[model samples]
Target: MAMMPRMELRQGQSLVMTPQLLQAIKLLQLSHLELQNFVEGELERNPLLERDDAADVPPHANGGDGPLAADADSFARAESLNSQDGMETRLGTALDNVFQGEQPTVARLDTHGADSLPVIGGAYGGSGGSFEEGPEGFESSLTAEASLHDHLGAQLDLAITDLAERIIGQHLIDAVDDSGYLGEPVGEIAERLGITSARVERVLAVIQGFDPSGVAARDVCECLSIQLRDRNRFDPAMQALVSNLHLVAKRDFAALKRICGVDDEDIADMVAEIRRLDPKPGRAFGGSTAETVVPDVFIRAAPDGSWLVDLNPDTLPRVLINQTYHARVSRAARNDVEKAFIAECLQTANWLTRSLEQRARTILKVASEIVRQQDGFFAHGVEHLRPLNLKTVADAIGMHESTVSRVTSNKYLTCSRGVFEMKYFFSAAIAATGYGEAHSAEAVRFRIKQMIDDEKPAEVLSDDAIVSKLKDGGIDIARRTVAKYRESLRIPSSMERRREKVAMAAGGR
Candidate 1:
């Protein structure tokens, strides 16, 4: 009986994830910025989808009998009808109800926290609205230029004779990373790109001459020398120091002195001058800043001294399915198959909308938990950063650990201090209160910052010394651990601290 083949004809049912459903589920977990980018990409690929670009377009731009509805959309959006396209060229609003009935006005994110706010991701906490407008007399502008690549392109256009050279130049420029070092050797690049080493060097030489000098160098010393040579200040002595960078880093002042054939005093002065040189000169001029991230959440100080937490409106993508287009697509359908295809498209459109709403709910939920757990941070500052883990947030948000990890990773929170990754707020639990609930690493970092700030500059505290102070304040931490934390905070060692202090003292005197 156990070996008999099954011949049952009984019907069974189970939920199977369709391709569309899978896509929807995947979309649900994306953070605010990712969701925005996803929607933008879809708008480009799908003719039936678009962002609410009404604010940017002028009325009467579309024209004639079907006169551009763009202008009217802009006016309407100005009146708070935040919309995707024009009113006349209406995107398919799933009609006969609510979203259509309440047709959204182009509501600008309230920089001053307006009455009602659109919902964003769980990356932002609370039901509050974000108020991000620069205050009176405040002008907002990012001074950073396009990038090293773009700058090189502009220069190449003016400098290069052949198109091939320009193409080769761009690849080389791109090869240079954020650190301004072309880590790949010119010969290796030549072999990989099927170009000659001499050609690569020539192109790189041109790139190095671009505004942020020394941009295309293969090494840090070479990068600095490129700048120095360009300025015509790279004398024999300076050249020796730049080339023997290893010795300089080893703090071998004597070796540097001997190499330059100068006294210790001259070496010290030369080293100081070299320190003033930009190691990553290319970055002195703005790069793509493509790595720039907009914080998913924003917290601002209220006049009453309370902090209001809200999501960045820009992060929440405003997407609408082209209802009118869908209708036309249906009308234009020639056969049953075509109609079915259109119907499927309609289904996907609806699923996208639902997924977006679900994303918003998840983001809001996560953000709310963060705000609750880190309330002390909003009120006090970084010192109040509680040592919270994914489990702590997951429990508070009623989600799984995996879900919390997704929400926190690559997400940002904007506060009065600065924009920080959400993950930055989550720290390992530190021992406090003898054996009770642990103190937040954030709290300890803040304490560390405070301790350093309060200490007299004449004597820099060592890591061991700092640990002793923390223990006295009821925090039980090891000396080496303090050193590790201090290092992470970019605090230098005791010797470096003394050097800086001495430098400052000499300058003041």
Candidate 2:
């Protein structure tokens, strides 16, 4: 064969990820808040993309100029028709598009002859006319509240005269967790600070007496005892009950009565007093705001006994290509740069709209498939949550496993049972008891939790016992598997449970 350059004609299909396609994929996985931020940025950069405000067109309609003809001079005139200020005014409407499920109205034009600016609605209390409605002091009050550490440090600095005691007190305060219990032992603190245990104890005792009655206690016993003493109820019975908190926790009233040398009535009163005290004093001081969980898909029971899967309108991004603006800009575009800009904007706007729609459809498809496959779970409970994986959903939906994974990732589905992460439906399979369908590990775990929760304190269920119970229920799981599941659920072993029960029983006395 001659090795020479030759011209050949061939055609082959290839997959290329364009920027718009990449954007679509990126948008698919973004949370609602993130998508809002992204859309806001796009609105700022693209002038042609304007939010669709559902207000009738102005009666005069841009100086009664019906429409511009497709001509160079008409385009030149159109260029002047939409000034930079007017374009900016249009872009301001982009803020309105950031929120979904709301009709975006035109921003009222400024009375001083400036173009109307669109303002974000009820987002961060920004000065957006009616959108500026929120609890005026709610956010400020939260921010102004003193934290646990601040509260303790202020009292320490004000009350403590000795510098050494104050220093030790500060270290001890730092050791106290948000739950008001000292994570580190007093002996360990003394070792770490080269101070005597007595000195650390002294400083701790003082810190415990801060504004919150149980601010720096070593354990629940100390926390409750401090509160009892503050209320002048630290009697022999109360002292005995406080010392044996473990028994109190397990509701061992008889044992608590014995330990406290009090009758049933006296023990009950002491227990009630202890119950009234705040175990976690630090919690009284506000902490970080809880992160809200928003579902991506909602599945409800249809009238026909079928599961209806729908995308959460709140999370779904609503966007559209402004054909009106695109036409205006296209006819007015003069130079190559201007024409290219207009064309690119039109393409991006169209692609974004299509991508959002596609994203919604794909999500709905995957979710619908999930609900179909795990229909029993929705109808019954987690016990019926079959052993599912991405491959199973992908096969059912006729999509690739990766696509299913992408759709499910960072996505949550809410149904009659509860809000659950999409991944929660999938679980490793457990071997069936010699026949029938394979068992779901999640169901087995739930079963184990139920068994433990229902077990009597005296008859605390061991892992082996759990394994036996599971076998009786037709789940062929081993002792180690039960142990692993129990650990995963953070359930203490049988011996620990027994001790806790015994302690509670003793404390009640």
Please, what are the lDDT tens digits per residue for candidate 2 over residues 1-509? 88999899999986666566566667767766676667666666777665443121111212333321223343334344444323211212212232344221212222122232243232111121223436663445554567787788899989886545666777788777878788889897777666579988988888888988877887778788888889898887678778888777666777888888888878777777777789888898865457688888777675646555656656654556777878888888889999998877777776666556566667766776677677778888988979988898877756677767777888898878889988898899999887869988899899999998898868988888888888888899989889899899998778778877776676678
Candidate 1 per-residue lDDT over residues 1-509, each given as its tens digit: 37866677888876665666566556645765566667666666666665555342112222225212223234334334223322221112221122222212112222233333343244322233444565632335534457666666688779875545555666676677766778678887666556578987888888888767777788788888988888788999999998898776656676788889999788878888788888876666565436567777666655654445565656666667888899888899999999887776676666666556555555555665676677777667777677888899887656777767876767787777788887887889889857666778777877887777776658788888998888888889888788878887887777666666666676689
TM-score of each: 0.69, 0.61
Q: Report every candidate's CA lDDT.
A: 0.66, 0.70
Taking all chains together, the TM-score of candidate 2 against the true structure is 0.61
> Per-residue error at 365 for model 2, in Å?
0.8
Misplaced by over 4 Å in model 1 are 1-17, 29-31, 43-53, 56-183, 195-199, 202-213, 230-237, 244-255, 258-261, 284-286, 289-295, 298-312, 321-334, 415-418
TM-score of 1: 0.69
Lowest-scoring 10 consecutive residues by lDDT in candidate 2? Answer: 53-62
